[model samples]
Target: MNSRLQHLLEQWSNDQFTEADKQELIEMLRSASAEREIIPVLQDMWEKTEDEGLFSEEHQQTIIKNILDRYPAGELPDKKEIVPTMYAIHRTHFIRRWRWAVASSVALIIGIGAYYWYQHMQGKRPVDMVQSTTRVQPGQNGALLTLSNGSQVLLDTLQNGRIVLQGGVVARIRNGILLYEGTGSEVQYNTISTPKGRQFQLQLSDGTNVWLNAESSIRYPVTFAGNERLVRIIGEVFLEVAQNPSIPFRVDVNGSTWLEVLGTSFNVNAYENEGAIRTTLQEGSLRVVGDRFNGHLQKVLSPGQQALTTKGNADIRVFDDVNAASVTAWKDGVFDFNNVPLEEAMRQLARWYDIEVVYQQPVPKVQLGGTIKRSLPFADVLYFLGKVGLHYKLEGNRRLIVLP
Candidate 1:
């Protein structure tokens, strides 16, 4: 037996293994030669817990099978050739110190049974098995559409058909997308707002597409009439403007910032709770102008660039080589937390899950990485967080209290 492996086994048996120890154990498990020694240690540990009824015989076998399935006989690839697969069972980055969570969720295979066993011994229930009836579903496609006449329509429940608006303008709903048809000289404004736990998609009369994230609202004219197409947005929005050099597109974010679109696709995050309004350009060019008390501060953003401006501040900061894909991941139904801080990640969960996050203590200085599907159940998402040492409690049905 290797001395280092022996030390790791001892740490595991004593419930004193640090994150580095667990990572080293995972690496050893990847190799075939080490498996010969590691498997017996796990079996021995399981046998010791058998009398205590920690896990059923069937459950123990399933855990062993899951671990073995990762490295089949004579099929384990070389260590240097292992490439991380996206959204794999083993590929999930959990809490701040759990760096291996960034590799995959399957990395928990070695610790899961032990985790349950320890919880049993400690007379505590697992997070998933907690006696709570509260269930918070994930966000879905939905929005509140306010017409020019102050009449509101719920887009999620409305059937697919043509919606007649003022000035003879027609807005059609097809497969959860709001599409506009026909032109009207009478300019009437319409607003689409998505509440918490909902998102929406829209297409302007000029063929420009718009995606509204949760807790967002966009107000635009029913038809494009002026030399420049303009819209006002609050919260986050992604726009794919139709190319029309003759009539440029413009966006007014929170009545404080403006985005001059030069026929391109970009995303604007102007949530009031956020520290700064971020404008990330996916492709083409955009000029971000800030309304300062003295004058206007502006910056031109190229592809993969992000411009951040604070409310009531004149200076605009540009971040070059930004991850535009990660910035726009929400538009594609993903929560990309690539180097995002803990509170910010919680804010996203608050919006998507329609839950308020109450911290029981001072916020932990933790940075999170990796991506999670927006469609996962709230509890499942919490389970991943628990694996990384995040202790949380669901209060009632909509409040998530983070414990220190």
Candidate 2:
């Protein structure tokens, strides 16, 4: 299909198509037989969209009306009995604005030569891929909570409403967010942790909001009664600190890195397996400090900056130009692997899907860039790696062996 026409179709499929655009699309669909054949594939893709909720029931009915108007009968897919082949789309100008089509950086489709594919006797294969009968589903809102007395509670299984009361604070789980009500003079500590393939959000007594990524944990007090509001975290977290000039907000990350702020929004990724702690600041100013041999190494970061502290090295480095969107993309449920090494990218996948990654040979020197919806099937994620000449296979149920 021509590029402009494809843009129009994408807009129409996203429910953002204008009346004028819809008229144009209908005329094109009626004029071209090849274009008309794509309607079935479009419908299938839309049905699998991660954001299908965006299309209300009424909007879906409208889309059906438009398709039936063109076909006159509900024989669109019947005419083309073949299932559409999937492909990986690069960051082309034509598809830059169509990220909504798929959940990830790359989208799957019927026609695209940019992706690698193999022809099979049965049908067309996008890649030499295999599917496990038991697919590992994506993670959801789940975590384990540990109270001051060491009592444990599974947050996911607990029903909403008041779940805990201690240290003059009442805790509740409302719509999947753990919330604390009422401030307290007496401080009681609590910890929340997300196991592999799970994530959760929390609202502190001070009104600060925190989102914990998979395989992550955070420890905080039930209320902010100290001179400074402090929390300790391991793994990854996106925090929006409530503004309190009287009490500066402090984050103790992995016991080595520290973040001090009056009130700001920032993300800290201190996954020990990642070999470094990265702090990306999005709003307001904050100081990132690393424990050094001499004393301390610190860098004050403004908005749009990132600080990195390598493992076994106390030296801190500041990056003025940071990809804030990509850094905190995890909180938004999208993996933005823009210029990320293959190893690093796989580490993220391993954590989210709770799969083991083993390189059968030397790792390929490949850097990938794209946005992928985290909700995509694990098989689809592997299909994307095939585009860069990297191949993988599932061993048993949870092991992924990457081959060059």
Candidate 3:
């Protein structure tokens, strides 16, 4: 056994190596002679991710041959081939990592960081490693529409057309978007809710376009009335307020904080589970106010700014140079994490996939930074998280046991 290879492989598995050490490992793989020995050792280490009988000798040989085919025999390949081979190695180990089960508290696969190359096939035979029976799918365009009289409609299955007629306002679903037209003679409240694994869009009677995030709800009047236009929200939403200077648009969150706007395009994340309510402005302006017994504290947010507040908190902090794209990426079907904590990132995974998170040990203080498509399976997201040294296992059916 090569002590250098073993030591480096161990360090590499734990992501404890430097760039120089990684380069050394790459050089070792370049040699067909060295690869012959390294492949078996790596395979032996990776087999820990799978249970008995799941990984076979034939599969190991096939994977080895597949990796070897990328490099020329008895000759060091060029940079292009070398880089791809490294990725292929990483991909293969990642694929293997997902088949893990925690039979004991101590992780059996201590030699993680192995990549498994997998081709995700949707609607086909579900992957067993993903626990297909209980695997949660990503959030989709869906919501529950509650009419003024309390009649409920599942917007996802509801066909496009005039869906509701209440208080003289005509509610229609056009191309998957719920829209309300005409003025209501009387004030009536309608609420649209996006469940844990769903989202939807709406156009209010005033022409404001609103995008709701998963696990969010927005309550507004069927038509504008009185001195001002008001709406209530919980969770996250992106709004493009229609210009109506005569009647300012106000967003009330949990009755403790609110945003007043004449006309603006902004995103508000008021998820009850999150630490703070974040209001990010993409265009125009708005006043974020936190209601307090000693009068309300307010902050004016310009384009490209974000205000952070909490329910009943008098102080509202503003972050100027925020990643607005990251703030609203969920609306665009992506998970963008920029220096986000492991707990926060997992919370996002939990909501979008409708899974519960369980920590066997104290949660690690690790920050992840990247963008991943929210459409991937829960296991696929776990694989991406694994790349950043965060290990997790899917428990029973709906719980994810995160490992340190």
Candidate 4:
């Protein structure tokens, strides 16, 4: 508002100030009563960046052009994305009017022109064309190792390359994953844990690839030593077990369900909170020990079929067009919920988003049917739910409120 300040800003536009003047102005921003009150004047100075001075001037126009180049108008806007917001704000503040303002008084801020441009160009908006977001969370080295001496180390730490040798085995952490190589005859036990809002994949000593879902842990031997290879899993895991018929591989969970497999690909969904233990075979046969009474309770399974065990004898059933992709989408980075109830869908969301579940209304009447990106900021999931016709709101960045 002061003529003196306006004069100084005008001089700045003419490239009269030294670098010290720029530093002084920047420092004033932190101390001034109305620090941003001077911004309009400073913005005028940026016009100098466009037309270079004989000595020096503003290169702002060139710089903005470069930054905007990194982001082009793409398909769908990720609901929880910041890029669009940044672009929107940037367009709002610049590129508004080419109306030549001969007087320096009206050119207080450089963005006034662009702000008007945004106001007029509102209706002809670009629509969603690309994927809103990638429906998968990045993989994390979420392994927790319980040592032979009853000690536990979170393997995800030691982020850099480090070798931890124990029980005649060499376990290394490259980046975040725990890599192992065995040398000795002794079998040592270790456990890998994935907390809420996280997941992990590991290769057991017997060459079984285990994909553990959120809020889960799997305990297994460091090396397969003798006749049998055994492991205990809590929560859920997709197993691609190695084949060795001579020595039976067993997975023990709960009290009744015991899985015996010989070289096969299968999945076990046995979360502690869930009432049933489901063992779905993808390739080989697994005998389910439903009742501790007899070994005969073991049921065989073929591809495209599933076995459900509930304290008693396990039942095997076939499915129509088994949801292979949706069922195993977590391994590939997705939550493919096709016609699943909100209560059931929230279970997966609760684990991945690391949030507590509390419904605000009669469980939503709608069924969730879509694939959502796991890595997106949790709100993206809720936003997509709304976009898909569900009525819900976010609370405290950690809760979802469903409105009836």
TM-score of every candidate:
0.70, 0.71, 0.69, 0.63
Clashing residue pairs, candidate 2? 103-372, 103-373, 104-371, 104-372, 104-373, 105-371, 105-372
**177-202 in candidate 3: lDDT tens per residue?**
99888877788899999988888999
Task: Give the C-alpha lDDT of model 3.
Answer: 0.71
Give per-residue lDDT, candidate 3, residue 276: 90
Q: For each candidate, what is the lDDT?
A: 0.73, 0.71, 0.71, 0.60
lDDT of 1 by residue, 1-404 (tens): 55565566555434476769766865765566864665454333333331332333354344334443332111222223222221222212222333222212222343433443444533655454444413678899999999988999988786587888877789999988999988886989999999999999999988999999999999999898879999999999999999999998989899889888868999999999998999999999998888723345788899999999988786899999999999999998788887888998999999999989999888866567767778766755776577567887777778788988
Query: Model 2 over residues 1-404: C-alpha lDDT tens digits?
Result: 45555576566455575768745744554454743455444444444444323433344334333433222111122213212221212211222233444321112121211121222211543223343513666677899999988999998776586865665678899888999888766768999999989999999988999999999999999987759998999999999999999999999898888788998999999998898899999999998878733345788999999999976678898889898988999899888888888899999999998989999778877778766778666765665676667877777778888877
Of candidate 3, the 10-residue stretch with the lowest lDDT total is: 102-111
10 residues in a row with least lDDT, candidate 1: 70-79
Highest lDDT model number: 1
lDDT of 4 by residue, 1-404 (tens): 54556654445445464557544533443344533565444445334333323311123334333322221111232334423333332222322232121122222222233333433433343222112122233345466667777777765656756555575677766555566786656756778888886677777766788888888888888887778888898887898888889988988876668888888888787886677787777777777677646767666666656777765545533343455556777777667788766777878888876666777667768766756556554434554576667886545545556777
Q: How many Å off is the CA of 290 in candidate 2?
A: 1.2
- Tell how far residue 352 is off in model 1, in angstroms: 0.2
Which residue ranges in model 1 land beyond 4 Å of their true spot? 1-134, 292-296
Pick the winner on TM-score between candidates 1 and 2: 2
Q: What is the alpha-carbon lDDT of model 4 when measured against the actual structure?
A: 0.60
At residue 342, candidate 2 shows an lDDT of 87
